[model samples]
Target: NLKIILGHMGEGLPYSMWRIDNRNAWVKTEPNYPAKKRIADYFHSNFWLTTSGNFRTQTLVDAMLEIGSDRILFSADWPFENVDHAAEWFDTASISENDRIKIGRTNAARLFKLEA
Candidate 1:
């Protein structure tokens, strides 16, 4: 199956992941949507998310905790946003340096199989 990449660091999906997991079952009776796994499972296995313009540290941290650092991608949200701002926030975000590197560049490079 093709990988599904999510932008805006999941566009608040990390928060919703649990909510869906909790509520998906409740909604199952209302809607006919069927899934064999928890919502977070799909998040962990099928999706990759980008920081893009949503550069909030707490949300980044929450996403990392909820999904994983390996799935997080970085972007400047160019045209609509400023690269310098993205850079500054990323540089100062409370997460570890390794996590920063992984999200900022390595993850996307690996996801796209880019050559150094």
Candidate 2:
């Protein structure tokens, strides 16, 4: 469990979660095949996505909408960007207070199982 948190998620696949859920990719190879749930289904509440370099508000909203408020995280990627900018953007983003709490703190705490 700790390894998953410290491990690297690989390159260029940050958005890979969305591609797997495309309608065209899920056709059954044979008849009577069961329809699979969207990638968002696998985005469990215990997992929180990093803000990383993605500072777009619409995309953030999409992620929140798809994965639920409880699975979003606030990140700055350190030297790549300033912490204040991330904090400000998230602080003023057009979303509900409940969602903000989820993305800004609750999600990270839950994902890392941090005690506070």
Candidate 3:
């Protein structure tokens, strides 16, 4: 399975997934459309998201609840956004310590198969 990682909190897909899926179910796609499963199915199976420029806590928590921590990775937008701000926000985020560790470090290591 090809794995794709999206930055900027999935470019807002986490919040829009339900709507996308709902519309997909309500409307018929063109015959040329190839996807047979729900958008959330693809997200759960093949996608990962990064906490890049987006730093809102409620948004992060919403994403975590929608997609689970295993599919998230921490990222600093670097030259585009201050690393300190990202670090400060993430360090003080209200998520549980277990989830914080997973999102901040372990998830990437596990996805990349790197030695810890």
Candidate 4:
């Protein structure tokens, strides 16, 4: 399966994952709904998110809680946002060092299959 990466924390989709899944469950009787699985399931299975221009720690933490650090990558939305600003914020974000390393480096490396 092709993996999809979304920038700006899936444009805020993480915040709505629970609602989407819950409503999706409620709508199980609808035959017209083409998706075979819940939205959150698709998120978990096939999606990755990037920090991009949205750099709030709370938002980042919320996304981490929703999808885990393994599915996140760091980005600056360069030209639109300052790379240094992104770096500074990310460097100080209130997450474990392991998670910080994953989001900042290893996650992208693994996702893109980069050579070490």
Clashing pairs in 2: none
Better of 2 and 4 by lDDT: 4
lDDT of 2 by residue, 1-116 (tens): 21222111212233566675565357765435464544435444224566666677887776666556665677776778788887888899889998888777886776667957
Cα displacement (Å) at residue 22, model 2 = 4.6
Model 1 C-alpha lDDT per residue in residues 1-116, reported as the tens digit of each score: 45988888787777887787788767646655586778788778989988888989988988898889999988888988899999999999999989988998888888999957
lDDT of 2 at 43: 43
Clashes of 4: 0
For lDDT, the strongest prediction is 4
lDDT for 84 in candidate 3 is 98
Model 1, runs deviating above 4 Å: 26-31
Q: Give the alpha carbon lDDT tens digit for every residue of 1-116 in model 3.
A: 88999999889888888998888777765645687888789888899999999998888898899899999998988999999999999999999999999999999998999955
What does candidate 3 score on TM?
Answer: 0.91
Evaluation by lDDT, superior candidate among 1 and 3: 3
Q: Rank the candidates by TM-score, best first.
A: 4, 3, 1, 2
Error of 1 at 111 (Å): 0.7
lDDT at residue 104 of model 2 (Cα atoms): 78
lDDT for model 1 comes to 0.85
lDDT of each residue in 1-116, candidate 4, tens digit only: 86999999889788888997787677647758587877788888899999999999999999999999999999999999999999999999999999999999999999999947
